[model samples]
Target: MKSICGDLLLQRLGPEGLGAFGKPLNRGLYECIRGAILDGSLPRATRLPPQRDLAAELGLSRNTVMYAYEQLLAEGYLRARTGSGTFVADTAPESYLNATAAAITDAGPRAMPGLSPRGQQLLANASASPTQWGAFMPGVPDLRRFPHRRYAQISARLWRQPPPEWLSYGHGGGLPALREAVAAHLRVARSVRCDAEQVLITEGIHQAIDLVVRLLGSTGDQAWVEEPSYWGIRGVLQVSDIGMVPMPVDDEGLTLPEADAGRLSGRTEPAPRFIFVTPSHQYPLGAVMSLKRRRALLEFARQHGSWIVEDDYDSEFRFSGQPIPSLQGMEADAPVIYIGTFSKTLYPGLRMGYLVLPRELAGAFQTAHAELYRAGHLMTQATVAEFMQAGDYAAHIRRMRPLYARRRAVLAALIERYLGPGALNAQGSNAGLHLVLRLPDDADDVAITAAARAKGIMVRPLSRYYLGTPAQRGLLLGYACVPEEDIGPAFDVLLGCLGECGHAAHVARIG
Candidate 1:
């Protein structure tokens, strides 16, 4: 056993072995042994060499070996037997050991656990980017300029002396203070008609949409989504087993047919149980739903007994004209679930968002939210509440609005300069973090997007946002996170890719 121990240790610990040359020898030995144990090179319950023998073999002082063994023993990595030598402890938990065994045994091709139909659909329809932050990555804010210092201070202060209840599982509706703050801000800023009681906090629009889908409708129920809509919401609907009817969008937003035609004639699909829209600023395309359209939608929903989900994400960043009031607040008792997120206005990592539910539905959604997800994060909510109360939230938006506007202008100018007129058309630049660059009818947006990505420019294919065959071919170029200086260069790279795709000719044309 002793002879075999030396060979095993020497083989495992390679040439410049146990001790890091410049560091303390004992600490280095300790780290090497710890790593070996963690990596399963030293199996659980394997006997370790006696301290004196190990010291002799390694030419180390007995005390040093003893120290390392003692530390390992104290940490439960090794167990000292009364009459026997030290062995690796069985402290590797059952779960860990089982997982390790499974990994080893299942190394070859094996039947993997099958996903549900819905799970398979989710995997097939997955649109989340592998890398979220970089040049021209759409839908991300400029995190570099975020007020981290102030937020950190507030976070630290709250954590130091948090309320007793706050440390526990929070209210399903969210932190009271946060709900009030959000309600007050929404009423004033976005004209959302809601009080604190109606504000149900969620992880973000993702979860908010999930709750609405689960609570209001059942599996196989029909819902209406824009022709080219936000893919995230489409995913939620699909996973919920809800059938989605893709409604086309014009310059005025979702173009719904007359209710009588939609319902009576078999030409159009039957009225959906719910309608999902981004009316404040249409996603990817940047068209505001006209007041007439908004009223028409509300009337349609009212007549059809359908609920509306207005995802007013990034509405606060509007660059031109007065900000639009929410569709939810436009009429009295409008059956609209107004969803907003701090992810865009603040930061995505915060994972805070809220829904202004209809008065009667709030209680049920709150109960289900608690039952299903078990709400917490009161500390984060409280910190955000303070930030809003102190007027920092509003000030941050004020500071970023112009900065984003400049970045938008730079990207737009580059497109006009490089791509030339009639080469590519850019739309939806009046508001939001991104805009749509419409390609020619013959262009393959998916191939163009892949080409752009290969050049280190991250742009989404406009066709990917559609439920069925895309009506238009284009790219969704996000300029929010890209610095003003980098926007031109990134778009130039993209233009080069476009030229390669034969979409843009190298003719000199005036902007």
Candidate 2:
């Protein structure tokens, strides 16, 4: 009998058993043993010492040890058999064993170094605790609310009056009608000037980034990324083994580290092949690049013979002020590769988005895309083309913009009233479906997130987005999916948790 067995027994028991304890001592013992079992520190089938022997080791009553074991027997996580010693349950989750085995295999001596670095990064970023948020987080539109009735009507009409080649694959660029509509949408909405031929439809912005990376940047080429930018882009760059030069971002979007006449000055190093930015609305920080900075960036690109990857992820949801002109529209030397997606504005499930690349890179990207998919699916592309042509897509964006803006406002006001300054200083509040809340320095974002989940509030910590230093701890609160009424109470819960975590006093200094 050992003192450790008492600890191990408690972990095998569930919360029900732990809560049933009438005394604090029982609760402590119950929790200790329960944790050990769940963590597998106490292997299955380890025989428990006799009750009297265990009681002697832990200085607990024999009755206490017996009672704990009996409670564990009632739970399916463990099992007992008469005349046989207690053993770990044979019925442990199959997936658990499979996962453990896979880990061992992956780490075998023969495994190559640097293998799965991307997978490792993904694991590090994945949330360890339960998320209070639902599946349709912010930045995700309600596709169910899409006007299916109207789209159905248009789709049916297109089917009836089919072009003889309607059944055939569209041009590698995209369906002409869809591209034309996108061109028109860009001109009127985003102030982008481009013909239908310039738009190359792909799956979404992620694929668009992939295409640009493949076509323009070679392996080991350097790419400048905005700090606290889109995580997917960071992941893509890592997987590609591309060198990353992190340019600091301010409230006015990405500020080149150096000043240059045409090239961004300060980089004594060779300029990156391209710099990736979310100019219309900066990603996590939500800073819109001013006209001056935009001009500087383009001039720098031109001087260095670099390209710019502009991810206009949420340009459609401009809440105040007119939409900004795209850098690609102002390109004098085909120096910008602008990527836009229907995923956020339309529906993510549509899997339709396009890249307006500089003419220099278009032919090569088209070749890469062709080899990757042979050709894009004809049916879905055709359906999407019809959706865009009938003006249904434009109408949907027009209808949802104000609705999301209202939600954004509600979320901002709630943050002000309930969380005060301590919880998060909401940035990027002027537009976009979500806002970033700067957390206190002492706060453990991971811990705060877990505590919030315990109270049924979902939020994302800003730390998850960064690859370098933990820029600032905060939550990425998405309002698009959350109902307007819940905004206030959600903050109330969040604020209450912040107070309990000893962070309330820091609230005043947060923003």
Candidate 3:
């Protein structure tokens, strides 16, 4: 089997001979092996030739062959037989194909029994999902310009003189050092008031949302989400099979008048058990939930015995005045879950975030954490903890705050210049990386975004984020990925698309 597999691999390496570099073979051999695996030339249970044998055949190191096999195994496309030998996992994910075929039948989704009906719907929709940003998309930080070299330096420092205890599995909550650093950072950055014990680190704000949703309301219970809210969070709620009640948001944010909550209008016919809001800077529309509204929401949540989930995704860089206090900090009672993410503040690839649970709920969350994912990577957590405790994270944020603020200003100025007055109406430009680009009423942003993509420009349609009513029809263009010099040209091209689509009449007058 190993010899046959080698012959098959050799056939794929027809044109470019195997060349060695680093631990993995050079581009030629890597592609050859990858192509064979993709094309099914190496069948299931075909144990690969021992590393030494193949290395000799291809003039490569045994380590190179081993590295390729390790990558394949990590990606779930192959399996190792321990000391016995390595072989392809069962030739295909036969179960996946059968499940997919079943999903298309009236039998109603057989492949992914793990997903509920709502989860199935979200998955189906995600299949055709487009780019993450639309024109003038707000709330996304410019991650392309992040200091990768600085982070590499920090990682190197931790590796040089590693702490023996940092290698163990991180605590269910988080590394105590990171938690302490997060608490101090929050105090200075967002005015959040809490001790380290209050913080429960999770994967991202989405996971924090899920943990809170599952902990607070079970499947089929009413959960109030802001209208024109984060669709990702809504999808998470849907997958959990929870009943979602869309609450109307005003300039102040989600307004459930004490009278409004109890009386139950058409929108709130079914009472909500909890309210999910992005008060610091409301998503999409960019409206800052007012201080008055924040107090009102807390009062209402307390009165109705409902929990509040505050997703403070990008509240650190408020350009104008002081940042608003988190609902968790302002709560008079014990029912708010405050979630934060380092994805935007640092880099999304870090994959670390935390949920600040109310004191009453921390014990239950700790119990739930044990069953999910076992424990987080202790080394990364410890390194990050050092980054924060040593004042590097705060210094990084200070440097980024002005850099991002300038970008926001440049984008705003460009919007004012090229699009003209009223061509775009923006909210939450006072903070956050992206802003809303409200388009003309009749414009079909979905079609417009498709047109932009053909020109190598990308934007997100606002309709993608909402469910109840077709929220505003406009694009969400992220400014974070576009460079400072490219902003003008990008918008010009974007504006040209709008004009080509016949919406230029509404836009041309604005500039």
Instruction: Tell me the TM-score of each prediction against the true structure.
Output: 0.80, 0.72, 0.76
lDDT (0-100) at residue 237 of candidate 2?
76
lDDT, candidate 1, 201-297, per-residue tens: 9999999999999998998899989988999999998989999999898888998875564373444466789999999988868889999999999
Task: Tell me, by TM-score, which candidate is best.
Answer: 1
Runs with alpha carbons beyond 4 Å of true place in candidate 2: 1-136, 155-171, 259-268, 421-429, 454-456
* Better candidate by lDDT, 1 or 2: 1
Give me candidate 2's TM-score against the actual structure: 0.72
- Candidate 3 residue runs with Cα over 4 Å from true position: 1-116, 127-139, 161-165, 257-268, 332-334, 508-511
Q: Ten-residue segment with the worst summed lDDT in candidate 3?
A: 100-109
Alpha-carbon RMSD, candidate 1: 9.8
Model 2 Cα RMSD, Å?
A: 14.7
Better of 1 and 3 by lDDT: 1
Q: 18-52 in candidate 2: lDDT tens per residue? A: 34555665555544554455666767776666668
- Ten contiguous residues with the weakest lDDT in model 1: 97-106
